[model samples]
Target: MLLSVNNITIAFKSKKVVENLSFSVDRGQSLGIVGESGSGKSATALAIMGLLPPTGRVTEGTIELDGTDLLTLLRNQENYRGRKIGMIFQEPMSSLNPLFTCGYQIKETVLQHQAVTARQAEAQLTSLLEEVQLTRQLGERYPHQLSGGQLQRMMIAIALAGNPDLLIADEPTTALDVTVQAAILELLNKLRRSRNMALIFISHDLSVVRQVSDHLVVMYRGRCVESSSVAEVFSHPRHPYTRGLLACRPRPHLRLLYLPTVKDYMEERPDGTIVEKMPDNPLLGATRGSYSPSQFDPLLKVENLTVSYQNQINVLHSVSFEVFPGETLGIVGESGSGKTTIARTIVGLLPLKSGKIYFQNYLLGKARPRSVTRQIQMIFQDPQGSLNPRMTIGEALMEPLHIHRLYSSRSERRQAVIDLLTKVGLEPDILSFYPYAFSGGQKQRISIARALIVRPSLVIADEAVSALDVSVQAQVLNLLKSLQQQFNLTYLFISHDLAVVKFMSDRILVMYRGKIEEQGIADQIYQQPQSEYTKQLIQSIPQYV
Candidate 1:
């Protein structure tokens, strides 16, 4: 084995994060460690690299690399990082330095690992970028200048600078669109095969992990519940946790009324044994719902909508669409494809170059009225970023009610807040807690509650569930659907995930490079995509087979 982790236990301070975890990878083989947040997959990766935080320690077992003890190297202050093992982190934007150019950063890594001159390192950096399928011109630009895929490629180029034997990818493609993700996965496999490198792929998405890894390890809370070949695991998942992970993700081929979560598949005893439960039939034939634009008056209309940044570059060009009163009009595209720009423009966050927006037949100008603001609320991609960290949930939810001046008394507003909390599957007791006290899923629920508190007729959800785990994403998507039905809410949903967009949208709009590529019924768009971009997006979706 190239790398072996035998009965390892990882802990931070007095608390155990990972217990009795065992896995191995041979040369030129890929091992996938799959789990959601707080499942200790990343902890195992960190332990192998000796990069754990100050409070964390390898409490038990052994980690061996090429028959050499990894802990011994750490204790002796010997460098195995970059020389023998390299890692690609989850978020490329945060992992890379923003101050320097991509070439400079990559060259610095090359110099640190290998004995090379400055000019030699620069030459090597260019070769690495080429190997990762990135252009040399992009290397001269800063991190922000690149797209999500480009940044990830740059990260891979840096990781490959050392020419390590083992590569650890920790959620490398989590933030990327389907097309970009497919490209990255292909590139990684190509590199691994050509270089004969052992790979440890870690991700929450089993479909993505299956594409890159030969073996699979399913984790829950801190234990390795199941380990087997990728094909075996997918064909016959033994653990309820594994089954839940497999079933939770939205599938392009299947339209489910409600995506099943981990909780729906199993109940965990206090002693930690799992009891499997029978899941309901969630399949919906053909489509979720049907809607034609001519059926009802348009709730929102955008005519010749054009938006530019600093009057030099046009981000949205002559975009036009109409949203019915009770249907979801999903906009699907990659980053910088003008998805969020449309949402932001309607919410009065950006200055349009030339356009006319009508909400309820009333023209919306640059500065919207208080009434318009109350009725057209937005849920952003990152819930934590949108919410105030210092403010309590009650204070955050009630701020909108206070601004709109709904309900006469403070007691009425409090009750309204409580009701909204309950509507979003949260408790009234959480009103006293701050945003930091909640998990990513809980924060997103709070964001949803805050958006719906004002009784918005039209809600713009921009990548709202993109960052959530598959199970949490299922819950959030179901909640959105239920809330929409109950409140008669109209959604202008925007996301890069096509399966999710297909599930939630009545009609779909495919966008590419600031232009509408295709727009039609949700089923038609998926089953019969006309444009090459749309077809590419659909084909890029990871297949179960």
Candidate 2:
């Protein structure tokens, strides 16, 4: 085996995150770790890379690279990191230093382990960029100047600078669009084949992992629930969790029933004990409560909206849509297709170059007061970036309320924060915790709570659930559905995940290059797409049996 993890256990403080998880990857082979959010996939990779935070430690286990125990190595071990192992993280924006040029960053990694002058390092950096399928000129660009896919490729170049035998990529393609994701996966596959390097690809999408991984390990609650060859596992999944995950992915020509998650059937007893019951499938439930088109009026209406950046090209062009109360309008497109720009324009973060926005028949485009901003709330794509890391969850939640002056009394404000947490399926005690302390899923839940604190008439979720796992995504989607029903709230749900959009959206709008290529009922669009872009998007979605 090129890399082997035997009986490994990792812990954060006193809580175990990965317990006795054993896996091995042969030379030139790919192994995948699949699981839901907080399932220890990334934690396991961190432990293997000797990059765990101070609070997290490898409690027990042997991480061996070709029979050399990596866990026993000291930080100063000369050949451990650069020569034997390399890692690529999930978010390129966070992983790359904003202050450095791409070439400098790559050169730094190469020079850290080798004796090389600046001139030689520059030459090596150019070759590294070429190896990662990027043009040499791009090396001079700052991280922010590069697109998401280009940034990810730069990260790969940095990871490979040392020519490590093993590469650990943790959700490397999660933030990319479908076409970009396929390209990255293809790049990784080609690199692995050519270099004979072992790869540990960690992600929640089974279909994606299956395409690149030869072997698969299904993880849940820090345990290896199932392990098999990708073909065998996908064909006949043994564990319930694995089956549920596979079933959750949107499949072409297959109508997916909403699969039950571990949380749905399990509830706390009156005495604070947990018990499991037969799971209730929400999608299979009676259609008796189906939404009617006439129940509520349009909460938000946009007509011929157009927006452009400062002294730049137009990003959104003549877009028009209405979000009715208690309805979800899904905007689907690739990255930089103006999906987010549209959301930002509607929420008043960006000025309309040309257009009209109406909320409750009031012209929002002309409104200048802060009161108009209170009725429209937006949840960003990256929860961590959107949230203030310095503030605790309670403080973050309370800031919106304070700004809007929703509550005057301290007691009432405290109660409101607690209620918001409960509404989002988080414990009230978590209110005192900071954003950095929470997992990706928890941070997103906090983001949702913050958006709902002011009780806005319309909420724009901009790729809100894309960072989450399948199970957590389902729960959050169901929560949004229930919340909309209870509060009569309208949602402008934006995402790249068609399955998620299909599950939550009443109407779907497909956009390409800042234009709405197609718009219709969600079911109709998915079942019979007319536009070529929509057809390609539907076809590109990963399929599962």
Best by lDDT: 1
How many backbone clashes can be found in candidate 1?
0
Q: What is residue 233's positional error in candidate 1, in angstroms?
A: 0.8
Residue 103, model 2: lDDT of 87
Tell me the alpha-carbon RMSD of every candidate: 1.6, 3.8
Off by over 4 Å in 2: 11-15, 53-59, 72-76, 107-127, 250-259, 264-298, 366-373, 384-421, 427-438
Q: Candidate 1: lDDT of 499?
A: 89
lDDT of 2 by residue, 287-321 (tens): 32333564666788889988888848988889988
Tens digit per residue, CA lDDT, model 1, 474-521: 889989998998999999999999989988888899999999999998
Worst 10 residues of 1 by lDDT: 281-290
lDDT measured at residue 359 in model 1 versus the true structure, 0 to 100: 98
For every model shown, the clashing-pair count is: 0, 0
